[model samples]
Target: MTSGKPISSHLLPLDPRRRRSLAWAAGLALLFPLAW
Candidate 1:
C-alpha cells in the first residue's frame, strides 16, 4: 500500500477528463482478455 500512494499522488495532477478517458481505456483493456 505504501508504494501505491506515490502513484496515486502522481496522477492527481491530471485533468478530470483525461483521467476519465484513461480509466475507460484501462477498463476496456482489463475486459478484453476475458472477452477473448
Candidate 2:
C-alpha cells in the first residue's frame, strides 16, 4: 500500500492536464448556447 501511494502522488500532476481539457470542453459546451 505504501508503494501505491507514491504512484498515486505522481498522478496528481496529471490532474491539471485533465482539468484544462475539461475546462476547454466545458467552454465549448457553453459556446453552443451562445450561438443558439
Name the candidate that leads on TM-score: 1
**What is candidate 1's lDDT per residue for 1-36, written digit by digit as tens?**
586477567778988888778778878988999899
**Top candidate when judged by lDDT against the true structure:** 1
Which stretches of candidate 2 lie above 4 Å from their native place? 1-14
Could you tell me the TM-score of candidate 2? 0.52
RMSD list, candidates in order: 2.7, 9.4
Q: List the candidate 1 regions with Cα displacement exceeding 4 Å.
A: 1-7
Alpha-carbon local distance difference test for all models: 0.79, 0.74
> Measured by TM-score, how close is model 1 to the native structure?
0.67
Candidate 2 lDDT over 1-36, as tens digits, reads: 586477557656787887577668878988999999
Worst 10 contiguous positions by lDDT, candidate 1: 1-10
